[model samples]
Target chain A: MAGDAGSIPELDQKKYDADEQVKIICLGDSAVGKSKLMERFLMDEYRPQQLSTYALTLYKHTATVGNKTVAVDFWDTAGQERFQSMHPSYYHKAHACIMVFDVQRKITYKNLANWYKELREYRPEVPCCVVANKIDADLKVTQRSFNFGKKQGLPFYFVSAADGTNVVKMFREMIKRAVDYKQNPGDFMDEVMQELENFDLEKKEDNSEADEDGLKAESPDLV
Target chain B: MSFEAKRCGVQFSPPSIVLIYEHKETKTIRKRIIPVRNFSKYSDYSMAAERLKNHPRHRDYLEGVSQSQLEKLHIILRDHMQGFSLERSLASFNLDPDEDLNKLDDEELARKKGQMDELFEKNRRHKDDPDFVYDLEMDFSKTTQEKCSWDEESDDGF
Candidate 1:
């Protein structure tokens, strides 16, 4: 759309049904290749350019999940200590989460624990995937990152977003799993809504009783 | 939740309005300590005023400071921070200056905008060059206003 030579492929609108769109968020430390992962998956190519995200980055990509095509809202969050305070909002109300760590950087892998912890505490039900990014680096570096992911029992994948490795495949699988899970979000949402409705009804009933008591006191023995 | 878990400690609360008065002649800055009775009512920015109002400590904090005292505090803090002028700072980051809405009404906004635009333009021309380190510092400061928007109040609200 910006008149680039090798433009990114747009989604085929005909493939989608009229159902709701599934939203997935991508979050991790800065320079963990979060934007590169997003570019490779959504744009199908990566530029050699560098752009530092301040607080948040948003991208919308459409991918087919089963028979219906879903539009996923991917949120890229800043990973500095100052930005750590902003992470909860991105984690809040997320449907699916991806915690990315750079294979070459050990500290990035360590920071994933905080990302995982915050996601669990804020939105426990959201499914997550841990990514070992920049795998094009040395094998020894990637191996360490993989071992860390295995220890956490998180479904891990090694991706080189620059060269367009398993990034697209991983995202496709994420959408499929999300669509499958949404087939029945179950009574968790329904039960919460019902409880809220019941509380409102109870409040209304109590207000009416108070009104009746006030009327009776004002016109005592009139009947 | 246990009492300790929900305990609203003084340190766990939001940051207070930090005022630093600068003397041009001496070039020294003095920090002023403003008492905040209701830590919840501390407004970091205008965008999240509603969220701050809804905070549990907001009411209690308001009770601590009278209306006139709060206004005085606002003026003191604002003046101390050079008006906390987002317009003056954010102008450097605007790529297309003419397209900008110029929402800030500061008297120095236009002059600051011109100076920042020139500096940003000069820096942008070299930011991508591998040998350009000094220009990157200018770029770094330009984006720092966005970092302010990520403070405690804006994050929890927006």
Candidate 2:
């Protein structure tokens, strides 16, 4: 419902035909409300005391953009570090990611850098969004230097998971970006397994080539 | 009958054979166990044993199966307290413990960076809106499964 465009009353079945599928992963520390955020965005419901995702939970939604429909695959990853080992499986298929943090807890915001650092080790250039959750509480304003907007160099949305504000707009933008990426042949995936297999090897070659290219290349292989 | 598992500082009790397997690289072997209830004893034992034998990593570790080993295994399965021990699963890749994982050309790394950029952009646009708020809405009524038939085939959070 978050990505829904209008309230015309009549359902447009034709728009659903041009759907492009995208996978978005919600990742962060335990008890950060990744699942709840997702539920709020997709279903517009809230559960205060829900169990953290033990493995991975998949949620599907279809958003109509103009004449095309976008199918979103939201993969919720478990927050614990022990469970972090399973991240590769989920990230392996992810097209984009939403790293969530709790605004009330400074430590949660501090860990955003680490999450970014870890995610940089793998994936291609996929769009990311940061969420500062739990705005319903009074702001202590201490140690608030962790700017959600400036540090990540990405889109950021502050929302109250409890009160339901700005959550829909945030997800709508995500779906739009996902849909844009999907329209490009280079991004939408079908034989991703094969591509992943050769990806590391390709990076190794590119890295060595970058050294020889001597920064003249438009984008140096970061690896 | 009792089945219990103790490892990594936590204990779990399942009503069937407790197969405690460890993985090292391609090799995987059942190293320890605490069997509590064995409704289908032979099938459970055979399945566990077969998993060990067929595991890609631990095939060499099986070696010869002596009569004494079989007796020990049976005793461990029959008795509630007696069980086996196994080493923790080890990764084959010799990665430095302190080495930053960002050096790896894994796909997750790239996606995260992009996600960060997107978050920054979103925040810049809506950081000060007074009406900004989070939403929590779900259709929990859609779930219709009233009965659960737990199956051994279901992976244990693999």
Task: Report the error of model 2 at residue A84, Å.
Answer: 4.2
Q: What DockQ values do the models have?
A: 0.01, 0.04
The candidate that wins on lDDT is 2
**Candidate 1 lDDT tens digits, B1-158:** 10111111111123344334443456565443333433233444222323333447443333322232233333333333454444443443343323312233332333333333332233232223466332111111222222211122321111
Candidate 2: list runs displaced more than 4 Å: A1-19, A44-54, A79-86, A139-145, A148-152, A185-223, B1-158
- Model 2, A1-223: lDDT tens digits are 1112212233232332254767777767654567657766765333222224434566778778778766776777533333333333354434577888766445556556556545543444456777777655532321133344243356766665555667787788787876665455354333233333433324323331221123223222343
Tens-digit lDDT track of model 1 for A33-106: 67657766766332322213434556777776656777766767533333443333354335677888766555
CA RMSD (A), model 1: 22.8
